[model samples]
Target: MAEPRFSRFAAIDWSGAQGHRHKGIAVAVCATGDAAPTLVAPPGASAWSRDDVLDWLLCQDTSTLIGLDLSPAFPFVDQDGYFPGAPDSPLDARALWKMVDDASAADPHLAVSSLLTDPEIRRHFRQHRDCGDLFPGGAGRMRVCEHGQRTMGLSPTSCFNLVGAAQVGKSSLTGMRVLHRLAGRLPVWPFDPLPPHGPAIVEIYTTIAARAAGIRKGLSKMRDAVSLDTALANLGSQPHRPLARYDDHATDAILTAAWLRANADRAELWRPQAMTPHIARTEGWTFGVS
Candidate 1:
């Protein structure tokens, strides 16, 4: 049997202070037949800026596809073709929609009129039906749920999931698929071997858990909230609200944990490290990610 083309692949989970600065930009790379993936940090004392991150990412000579969990671009189809999400100041959900409009006009092939109603798109979107309401243009809208309807301020089940809904879930789905694809391409630059399957899962778990544990510790340190209610109050006036945003530190850590737990392999290798200046310098990875 032919070996899978990809042996070395990397999975990165990036986040802010709510997450671990040490593991803020978690990276895991593995190679075929290797006992475990060599988890390395970039050598530096500087934190990663948006541009720096992209520069570093584009600079990676790994030749292997790099899977980034961040929004590389918005995956939406307006009247036209596809549009990539831009990293711009005042970046928000609204800007994303506008770009979709622009992409549609610039390229005729890019229009998404048919894709929205396509059976495959509809089926794939159903997995996240709870969050969005897809409206077939001129065809009226199908209410998916009350919460979605209220959130989009559209008639129940009449709004499109492509817009205000399913952001996190959709991004996650995209990330996982990218990871799988990158894993198929063998390592190219500064190639390192991957640990056994068991250890790999362990490392992934530890990294994610470490981030979660850090968040719990920080909340404790600030005395933000000993209880859920107190924490919510400390954060704002909202009742029963989470201290952290769904896309904030907690979400990333939780998602990372979920990913690790799901991909557990008995033969993988696991290892983690603290962010020490010497270690950071030696590893050639940034110490502080701004």
Candidate 2:
């Protein structure tokens, strides 16, 4: 068995919907043992704001490993660059995060509304009515790990396509801003080498965690205690306490946190076969994508 690398694992079900507080957002955390993950209530009886997540993350001890259900970057590999043909595009992930944060400096609640409005940046995405002229059709550009997800019978959304219910573009843009803020304070995997000890962040797809927990594909969303507990049990986690409401957002975070606890020390997960150094620096990968 792999030795434990982190004492606590946390998962954040992030949202990119235009709002200060989002009902779709949820957070769950668990420890090294088999105890079930606990849903963290948003402060003030309201839904969790993206900024609230950043604040909570900053407060977590160094022993925690945070996983977020948001893409840290747009595709760069297929097109040979993040913004093909666009001059002076960010050279690396940190620069991309800086550009995103700078573009939305005026946006409140850690949102990146202003970033989407930027003409230069807007040319790469497919927003509501306007399909970017540069937008590559037929599923858009995909990162290496995204392709792996498809190979494993999981469909991963391209961050460049901003339409549809599963649009990851907004979430990614907004999360990039938070990532920029956390740059010096926390080390995001691949962007910075995984430190020997300290709090670190990794991009996580809740579906990946769900599938690993033995939840069938396309049916990973748990809407009740029984389904949630069954998935938890598959990961050697104890049964979760009864929740007043069992929605996808809550269940996803809870299950992913437990999954993170179980898999953090896996050697192959940290070092994927297809991930080259250039890919890691250009497009950070999703955890468990190997």
Candidate 3:
């Protein structure tokens, strides 16, 4: 198969925080021939709002391959929908996105905590507060992609597990709201048909890219200049500015951008064996994961 060629590569480290501007959110970009990826600040702002990121993405002229570090959908295969017993559970991924968008309609920043009001939906998740009776038991509750990630030796938290620092559920929920708005503007990979031109967004896990770049497992974040530079070099990216602090958000964006560029031509990534039609339309597979 011929390699998919894009004019530019970019990645966004997303956040679920309820605010106009988020410090945790970061954007990184690299051109076809650029030496290395550079952090991008939101225009005239110290930090980026979810809206700002969307606006920036829409304004780009080149055909860009964008990676978003968040789950585009939830675990629907096991229960057939996010809320199994509920009367009106979303039938598919697009339906679920609409549900989230509707719930968060008043919240312009895409805050998703309000969805917890539904008792059935809240039962499946473990919030930061000790919700002893609410924790859903066993790995069967996890999505197929989460299970697949563990099988590949990458520890992936369930998108339903909304508690703790490592949980991705909140980010994923908020991200769905953004996706609903970008429906026509950005075609998400494996969900919407890939556009012949313009930008295409895909779900990404930075740890997958980090491991491919030779970073050891168990290290929480990439600190120091040597390790960061080495990981970038492994992706065939030129040396970049040293990290001033141990920041996973910044490092993930930088490394994932290079990883996307390095692996853009790999035919296998575009078509993973496990990416069945149901998975694509509902659960949504992570890019680069087979």
Model number with the top TM-score: 2
- The better candidate by lDDT, 2 or 3, is 2
Q: Which stretches of candidate 1 lie over 4 Å from their true place?
A: 16-23, 71-290
The Cα local distance difference test for each model comes to: 0.30, 0.89, 0.82
Candidate 1 residue 13 Cα shift, in angstroms, is 1.1
What's the residue-level lDDT of 118 in candidate 2? 72
Instruction: Locate the minimum summed-lDDT window of 10 residues in model 1.
Output: 281-290
Clash totals in order: 43, 0, 0
lDDT of 2 by residue, 233-288 (tens): 99999999999888999999999999999899988999999999998998989999
Model 3 worst lDDT window (10 residues)? 131-140
Residue 220 of model 1, lDDT score: 26
174: Cα error in model 3, Å? 0.7
